[model samples]
Target: MSAVIESHGHDDHHHGPAKGLTRWLYTTNHKDIGSLYLWFSFAMFLIGGVMALVIRAELFQPGMQIVEPEFYNQMLTLHGLIMVFGAVMPAFVGLANWLIPMMVGAPDMALPRMNNLSFWILPFAFFILLSSLFMEGGAPNFGWTFYAPLSTTYAPPSVTFFIFSVHIMGASSIMGSINVIVTIMNMRAPGMTLMKMPLFVWSWLITAYLLIAVMPVLAGAVTMMLMDIHFGTSFFNAAGGGDPVLFQHIFWFFGHPEVYIMILPAFGIASHIIETFSRKQLFGYSSMVWAMASIAILSFVVWAHHMFTVGLPLAAELFFMWATMLIAVPTGVKVFNWVTTMFKGSITYETPMLFAIAFVVLFTIGGFSGLMLAITPADFQYHDTYFVVAHFHYVLVPGSVFSIMAAVYYWIPKWTGNMYDERLGKLHFWLSFTGVNITFFPQHFIGLAGMPRRYPDYALQFADWNAISSVGAFLFGASQILFLFIVLKTVMGGKKATPQVWEGSRGLEWTVDSPAPYHTFTTPPKVSL
Candidate 1:
């Protein structure tokens, strides 16, 4: 194949994937770095999934089967930490790396070497975190939420390692996000303006800003916890006049946006897939951007909603309740936009579109649950229970994770220039969608029926749902193995992909060479529209 195979964009030159370990160590190429982020995230996802399986296993029957109580605590802690920082966050960053530069018609990320450095920090950070599992006591066993006092005075010998690792990870994310923001701000091709840029880019730009603003706050919170742990400061020490509740506030302040951080790029992806398969101009395209921005801004204010049952004062509760509900308006606008975009259009159920459609239906269910969680009195019943767990897992698994699957399905052809086995892809999708619903849906019932979260065992009354959930979890886990096979098989070789990988797709990314040329297309494509 000649270096220049143009179906979507004109190419004047070519480059190849970076050279060696050092190339990986110091890579700046957007695709190379994106590949690294993605591979790393997938590994972390499986690791975290294993931990979750352990959790589900212990909860599967009514008693602790395979793990000790302390070990159970450790499993819960590491699972949350890894899944949040490891699986979910990195997946979005990986998407940003792969799509943002291409989506906005940029040459590559703005700070390529720094990009390398940021990513390299992750293995070390996670190493430290995972290594803590072997220490004398155990890894930090407070939940991944890691509230103070528990995380401070009573934490294990490994808390320091957890904090240090988190610091490095935060640094990595900040750098990655900064690169995305800078690349989008500066690197667009000749005719691509702000509005003309893809929704993926816009969603990530907002996501990146959110990352920059909040990751540091998280670092600071941990640093404060470290001081309270070792340096003997009172930041979260009730004895020294510090308040534990204050820690929750700060944590959630970072956390709430962090949740959006996971899903915003997903919104971008789901939007792209839905529009492509639906064969419609994205309904209210500008409105979609505005809605995302609105969600981002609103995310910051709703952190306290997560803490409502903490016994906040009446006014504070009222304020948070309403503020939380207010987020629905913009979110509803986005959901409506997707539905309306699909409305009256030729709809196809290709794998990418299947995942996209699933994301809409399931993510809305998650969103509705979130609304229910936001109501002050209602949350009193649901808070700290499996209800909350079910709500978030829905948003994340089907919500963020499914969209990631959609993105891979959508773009595998472009990257590999080989069609993924559609039959295999559909198999992966159905198993995943079914497994996910079975895994999470019943938990909502269990939660409302009073199943506490972060527990390894439950009473016999909760046994049935937990058993069903665990089985679904296993199937979900096994289904992902099919996904791995499909992606790997496609990458190894398959039918050749056209430049416009999908018949209805439109983008600068598609304009580039399939299995896109290294450093090619320095001459950006002129926007035809």
Candidate 2:
């Protein structure tokens, strides 16, 4: 393959990317960086999946089987941290790096060099985090949320490393968000207005702002934790004249919007897939943009809902509960628009569409469960149970994870210049969907029956559901191998795809050559709705 591929821009002297390992190290190309982000995210996904298996294996029966209680806690903490930070966030950023420039007819991200730096820093961050698992006291086992005294007073020697690693990751996220904001705000092609931008771009625009707003809060929280542990500050220490509840306040303030940071890009992805597969213009394009913005705004206020059982005032509980519930309004608008887009239109259940539909249905289930948990009185019953586990997994796995898969299936043709095997793709989808339900559905029942979360051993009464859930988890984990195989096979070689890979697709991204050129729209192609 030639290092230089011809781009659609007027420049005839453009050169292709360099070959070999050096291509990744010093390159500022958005596409190469995007590829790096995607591959890195996949590796983290596999690593996290293995940790999850360790957890499920232990919980498969009434007693511990695979690992000790301490190790189990490590696995639990690492799994959550890796999946949220390592897999989901980076994957969405990769999509933004790859598609946002192309969709908006820009040459590349505004801060291309910073984009490269941000991505490269992630490995070290996660490396430091994972290395703590082998340290003398084991990894930070206070859970991914790392609530107050557990992360401070009783924490391991490795907690210092964990804190530094968190700081690094937060810095990376902040940088990535800045690059996205600059590129989207300043680099659009002439005549391309905000209202004319694709839903994906709009979603990312809102997401980028949310990331900028919240990542600093996370950094502050960790810094406070560091002071509490090392310098004897009592920001979250009751003995030192601080309130432990304050930690939850600070964490959730950042944590709530952080959840949206993972899912908003997914909303963009589902919108594009639904509209493209349905052969219709998005039913409520303007409203969809507003809805995403609305959701982002509401996210900041609802952070306390997660801490409903922490003895907040009744007024505070009512305020958080209603604010949290209000998010459903904008979210519901998005779902209704997707269905409306699909209504009475020529619909095809392609691989991407399959995943998109599953995301909608399963994510809604998560959303409804979230609403149930938002009820102050009801949350006291549901707090820290497997029901909470089921809720987030549904949102993240099928919700965010499925959307990432759908984006790959929907756009791989453009990225690779080859069409994936439809049959294999569908098979992967069905297996994943079934596996997810099998794994998570039983959890809901067990949780309702009073199975608290993060326990290595459960009473015999919870044994059947635990075993069944573990089996489903193993099945789901295995199905991902098929997904990897399908992706690799498609990349190796398949049917060649045309410029407009999907007939109904409409965007500047599809206007260029298939397997999109290394440099595209260098001359700033004109855009019009």
- Give the candidate number with the greatest lDDT: 2
The root-mean-square deviation over C-alpha atoms between each candidate and the true structure, in angstroms, is 4.0, 3.1
lDDT against true structure, model 1: 0.89
Q: For residues 1-529, write the lDDT of model 1, one tens digit per residue.
A: 2312431232333545557787787666778888888889999999999999998888889987999999999999998899889988887887788778777767767777678788888999999999999998988899999988889888997999999999999999998888888888888888888998899999999999999999999999999988888897999898999999999999999999999999999999999999999988899999999999999999989899988877899999999999999989988999999999999999988999999999999999999999999989999999999999999999999999999999999998887789999999999999999999999999999999999998778888999999999999999999988998998999899999888888779888888878776564466767756
lDDT of 2 by residue, 1-529 (tens): 1223322232466889899999899878899999999999999999999999999988888876779899999999999999999999999999999999999998888877788899999999999999999999999898999998899988989999999999999999999999999999999999988999898999999999999999999999999999998897889988879999999999999999999999999999999999999999989999999999999999999999988888889999999999999999999999999999999989999999999999999999999999999989999999999999999999999999999999999999999899999999999999999999999989998998899999999999999998999999999999999999999999999999999999999999999999999999888997767
- In order of appearance, the predictions have TM-scores of 0.96, 0.97
Off by over 4 Å in 2: 1-12
lDDT of each: 0.89, 0.93
Which candidate has the top score in TM-score?
A: 2
